[model samples]
Target chain A: MSMYVDMILGGVFHAAVVFLVAAGLQLVFGVQKIVNLACGSFYALGAYFGITAVAGAAAMGLPSVVVLPVLLAAGLAIGLIGLPVERLLRTVYRRDESHQLLLTFGLLLVFQDVMRFLWGPTPLTLDNAYLAYGTAEFAGVRVPTYNLLVIAASIAIAAGLGLFLQRTRTGRIIRATAENREMSEGLGVNSNRVFAAVFTVGCMLGTVGGALVVPASAASLEMSVELVVEAFAVVVIGGLGSMRGAMAGALIVGLIRAVAIMVLPEAEILSIYVVVIAVLILRPAGLFGKAMA
Target chain B: MNLNRRSVLRGIGAAGLSASMPGVFAPAIAQSKPVRIGILAPRSGAMGTVGECGIRAVQWAADRMNKDGGIAGRPVELVFEEETSPKDTIERFRRLVLQEKVDCVQGLISTGVSMGVAPVAEEEQALLIMWDGTTQDGVKEAMPDARYVFRSTDNECEAVMSSLLSVKYFGNKIKRVAGINPDYSYGRNNWEAFRQILTRAGVQYEVVAEQWPKVGTMDLTSHIAALKAAKPDFIFSSMLFADLPVFMKQGSAAGLFEGVNLALPAAGWQLNQLKKSFMPENIVFGHNTLYFALPDASPLQKAFVEDYMERYQQAPHWEADRAYFALAAYKAGTEAAAKATGRWPKLDEIIDAIPRQEVQSLGGPGRFRADKIAEQVFYQGLSTNDNAYDFPTLRTVNAYTADQLQKPPGMDFWEWLKTAKLPV
Candidate 1:
């Protein structure tokens, strides 16, 4: 019974983090029509920056309870890095998909070295902030209260994003641009600004995910590349350019992983890919993805 | 000769070749030539910091040797290359030996890498001193008759030692055992060796849960939850990288550490990164062959700690200590060979002299056995916050002698462990 509770909580917590990064991937691809392979770099940057931010916050005598908000702010601030990255990516906007991939892959490599230079080679962790929120009990099983908060936070963000996209004036304009860039431009919408905004928001989602997860995990040079693997898995399983797909994909992947670890430990990673293959075979467009015209 | 275009080009080519490939041209040049050592260490990934520490120690070794009139009276020159994957490393090894013409090659931390490069060393006839290749069972099985390759002490020593120390500290209370090790050869070997020793020592315990996360797994919440659910009295883990710190964080947050006795044999490598708040009281940590405090009054250790702290602003760990051993062995063996032959010795001569020679190290006296493995005393101890240092220090230090833990030469590790007796 406790094991079942653990599986559910662990899976949900993991899904929350994965969903943020995947949502970012979906948004960028939806609007820009470019696969930002450097999405993982943004996540890594946020994680490292989150550590620094928490340290700074602690030195300022901020209470431990506020660590979550501080991390979110740090993630959002660091997300501005996407502005410059998006600008640089503009040169390859009209180029081939291969060129975009190669360019982003190059950025990923460069970001790794740049991070090493700034943070050193050792993995950085946020120690005090992790247990700050404390743990909660559920039917004899103990879970971190922070995990629950992050789950709630993720749901709130998902709803907020969904509402904004479906309701707001700017959101509609952004959606319109994503739907048809040339048509939106003819209607006097600034597609360049829209792309920049969408890319930055997408980057923020990744950074925030990284920031939130850092307290529980670590910020290592390898995290960027490692996260890319999972994020891609989420994107493919959910649908390439669909936000709803991102959420569904993350949950499925996360729950499957939790279940796999419990049953067959060796197939933890293999199980995710197996489902990916199945999803690709069964629903080539992904669970929530729209079928192509 | 006529100054034709072809002749001019030929002359330029010859001059360039002579200048760039001096080792190829000047094979007969005696004395005053530098003794170049090729070093391979991971410089840009998870192992980078540990590798950087090894590089610092080797550089210090070279500096000290030069200050004392160099290795065999030749100034030491180090040629460094990043040790990436096995395939890339093999190519780098060839470049270091064939292109740069280094006298000796050293420094491989990964067991997989050591297994890959050991045979290559034999093929190239290069003197290879491995700073770390902890897999005792696999490396021995792959190259039992290796002449060119010399490795540090078998990693089994530390595992066995960790088991002994854990039993000594928590033996009476431990009824259930669990493991959360990296899913790799190194982690598997550590857990296997530890389990063997514990089971063989007649410490009856039930196996509850075993979690083998991939090598770079950052999140271990599920593993922690699994362990907590199993309610293991003692947990053994060999996650020595970023994963260790993450596990500690997540595990502590989940309150998993409170009731569980943890034995982490490689946690000393991440001693600095570990937090006092997250650390459990009843845990035993292994340092492979290093204790930052050194404990006893050894002038060599005192000097090394002081010098390393002043230079790098950090305490040296097992990687640094291993690097020192590698260099000290090379210098001792090379000098011995030279003294015996009355000239700069060959690779075979160095190999012959190494086992016969004893070298002093930070960990104390060290010497290779006839099987070409260094005999090192492994350290495992309880963590204490009573120390003045910012990070937690080891208390109740226990040393496990290599002879008691290591398998006898020409014997398989698992086969020997069945009949092996450790002092309870």
Candidate 2:
């Protein structure tokens, strides 16, 4: 029972990292209709920024309490880097889908190389400040309190996004533009502005995901490819335009991989593809995605 | 890219003439030609740390050789290449051998990249010296066909056997063992070899748990939890590069190594890369390698580390030592072969000469087999932070011979393990 509980907790925490990345991919696809292959770069940049910020704070002799906010600041700073990139992406929006992929894939490679030049190839580890508090016992098993913080943050982000989209005026405008860009433009909505906003938010959330994860896991150059590949799977399985779909897909992938790690190591990655193929053959929309009319 | 009959013959003519040149390249040496050696290591991935160190070491050795009047009195020219990924390894390797026409190539870090290029080297009849990749069993299998390949680093079996033997025979209450390794052929191979040795030795022991995380996995929560649950006395790891730096922090935070004995085959000095604020405790590394904090086995070893520290302004990785040693070994072999055959001998002669002569390293005096595998004394020790540097490093250790840990002479590794006595 305890083993199962621990596995479940592990799966949930793992899912949080995947969800943070995939949700941004989902958001960009929903509004801009562009699958940012470079979404993983944002995640990686966020992680590297977090490393810098945490290191800077330590150098200044700040208390460990300063690390969390510094990590958040790092995420926001990485979000700034996405602005010019989003403008570059805007130029290719009218091109073919292949062009978008080629451009973004090129960015991915550039980002990886740039990271290597700056940080070298070794992974840099930056500890979470909350780790000082030690493990919190739950279900008769000791768990890192940082894990709980990450899980709660993921949930909070999900709920907060839902409310923002449904309640706020700006969020509704973004959603309206996503539904039908030309129609929304005819209704006096500026699609370009909408895309800029959506793209920035997308990059921001993706990087924040990276920032949150640095505590639990360190960041490295190879991380972008691994995270991007996995996030792509989540986006594909959940349907490209659905945020909730990404969360659902992440849980399924995460829990299944977690269980597989315990029971059958071979099935950890294979089983995710099995479900993907099943979804393609059966629903074709996703576990929570809406069917196209 | 098109191969024409004339072009093929022209290329072949150049190659054959280079090979059959009279007076062992001395004429070229006198006429301003240099002995070219190619080196390949990762410069843009997580493994880049070692690659950067390797480049410096190779240059350091090559520069020193040239200053001392070069190889065979011809200045040694070193060409460095990136082993970017295993996907492009063959193309890069061929470029080094055929296009640039380097006389030799060394510094293969990834086991996959090295294994991928071994057959190509053999086919080209090039002198391919493997400096630091440790997939011994697979490399050993390649030896019968891989005529030109020789490794300076100890293989998986030889590297880990000493410490495993010590813990099993000499320790107290170490009956349960668990392992956390990167999910790859290298890690799986090490685990399989280690478990086989433990089981065959017939100790009162059980492997309580095992975790094979994907190679670049940063999240080790589930794996650590599983290992902690198993409650083993020792946790062995084949984790490398980024994984080790992360493990030191997270594992220490989770109290993963509070009482349990932590063990690693290599990359143990990865702990030294961490800050003093976040370091793991009481790790028993399998080898007294990881150059930054090694036992001074010889005067050469002492001078190398001191010189390396002065030159680089930081502690050199064991890879730096290995790279230096590989070039030194090549130089030694070339000299020996030249003395015997009265010319710069063929690739076969150089390959044969390398194993016949002993190579000095930070670990101690070592030699190679005809099959190109290593036979040397290894030191395995528990690690402690001396606080001499910002991070912790290894201190005390127990020494064991390659003959004791490695497979018996002229017999297969598994076959020998089946009958070998428990080293009491």
Candidate 3:
């Protein structure tokens, strides 16, 4: 029973981060009609930048207890790079899907090299900040207290994002624009501003996820590329452009991975893709994804 | 004097034919043509940092060799290509040999890429020296009678040495063992070899948990939780590159290594990044063949370390040592062949001379086996922060010679482990 609890909590921790990146992917695809494969790059940037921010804060004599807040702030700030990136992404928004993929894929490669230049080739991590809050024991299993906080934070972000999208006037306008961009433009909505804002928000979701994960994982040049694979798996399984699907997909993928690691051990990654393939075969649209036209 | 098309074509054909025939003008060709060594290493991915380390060392090796009058009196030229996936690397390997006309190819860190390029190297008849291919089974299976391929010490060596080191120190305490290795041949082979040694040594233990994440996996939280729940007394992992630092950070945070005896056999490549704060003091870290802080460093080791630090702005690790070993082997082999035959050695002559060639490596004195595998010392040590160095250095360092660490020439590694008496 304790083993199961530990496994579930572990899965939840992973799902929290995966949900953020998948939410960003879903949002960009929902409103901007552009599959931002570079969302993973934003996450990696967040992680790398988070390390710098924490180190800089520590150097300024800030208490180690402030590591979480500092990482969140760094993630949000670094995510603003999505604004300029969205501008570059704007050229392909009206173009074919191939063009968007090529541009974003190229951006992913470019971001990898850029991070390499900034952080060097070695993976970077905070020295002692991960355990600043200490470990919490439950059912004889110890988990980092930081993990619980990140999970709570992710849930809060998810609820806040859902509320903002469903309840706000700007949310309706953004939805209207997503439904019919030219019509939204005729109705006096600046689709450009909406796109820029939505894309930046989406990027922040990914960046925040990346920042949150760095406490537990080192940020590397390959992190961007590797996360892209898992994020895509989540997006595909949750149905494209669906926020609720992202949540559901993230949990399923994460939990399944956790279970697989415990059971088969060899099928850690293979098990994730197996479900992905099953979803593709059985439900062409993901678990919560809307059926395509 | 006649400027007809046929005459000009015949003149060009004759010139090209003569240029292609090195035997006709051997001395002039040897003197004029630079000895080009093709270097293939990952420069932009997970292994990029360590790959860059190897590249810098090989570059430094070339410069040092040229300073010492070059290899066989010919200046060294290195052509580099990225060692990515096996397919892309194989394509690059072909281009490096066929297009660049390199005398030899060196520097492959991945076992997959090395295995892929092994047959290609033999087909192309290019003298290839692998800097960090550590899979013995793959090598034995793939290149059975390989004449043109040489490799670094096998992964089994480090695994056996690490097992010996672990059991010798903590055999009485360890009862339950777990593993979290990368889901690949290197990881699988390391764990298997380590397990085989433990079982062979009559250490009564049960495997509590096993996790095999892919090579570039960033998250090991679930794996850590599972390992914690299983409550193993010892955990063996073969993770390296970015994965090692990530595992150390997450595992330390979750208190996974609090009471567990961690054995990281292939982690010596990550000594620089595995700082003192996060890395536990009691864990056993294997540096393959290169111990950066050997109590008594040789002149070559001291020179290599100081020169690498000056040139690369960091301490040299096993990757750099691998590069140094490969270059030293090439130099020794070519120079010996040149002296023996009274001229520049041909490709086959150089290949023949490379086997059984002795070279003083950064680790210590080393000799290549008749099968082109370099036999060197393996070091395993406990991390100590109170050392003289800025980073965490090793204490209670144990060095195992090749005889004790490696399998016999014709015997299987597992079979040899069953009867081969280990130091432990």
RMSD in Å for all candidates: 6.4, 5.5, 6.8
- Look at candidate 2 and give me any clashing residue pairs: B291-B318
The prediction achieving the highest TM-score against the true structure is 1
C-alpha RMSD of candidate 2: 5.5
Q: Write the residue-wise lDDT of candidate 1 on B198-278 in tens digits.
A: 777678888898899987788887777777778898999988887888888888888887778889888887777778778
Candidate 3 residue-wise lDDT, B265-347, digit = tens? 87877777776767887678888777877879898788878887776666678888788889889988888888788888888
Provide TM-scores for the models.
Answer: 0.93, 0.90, 0.91
Candidate with more favorable, higher TM-score: 1 or 3: 1
Whole-model lDDT values for every prediction: 0.83, 0.72, 0.82
Per residue, candidate 3 scores C-alpha lDDT tens digits across A86-119 of 8888888888999999999999988877887778
Residues A1-293 of candidate 2 have per-residue lDDT tens digits of 77777788888888998998899999998988888889898899899888888888889998876666788788878888778888899889999999999999999888877876676566776644537446788887677777887888889988988899889999999999988888999999988888888888889888888888897677787788899988977876888789989998889888888887777666768878888888888988887777877
lDDT of 2: 0.72
Off by over 4 Å in 3: A58-61, A138-140, A281-283, B1-33, B134-139, B310-313, B389-391
lDDT tens digits by residue: candidate 1, A1-293: 88888887888899999899989999999989899999999999999999999999999998999999999999999999999999999999999999999999999988887887788766788876888988888777778889988899899999999999999999999999999999999999999999999999999999999999999888988888888889889988999999999999999988999888877788899999999999899998898887787
TM-score of 1: 0.93
Candidate 1's C-alpha runs over 4 A off are: A59-63, A138-140, B1-30, B134-140
Full candidate order by lDDT, most accurate first: 1, 3, 2
Ranking by DockQ: 2, 1, 3
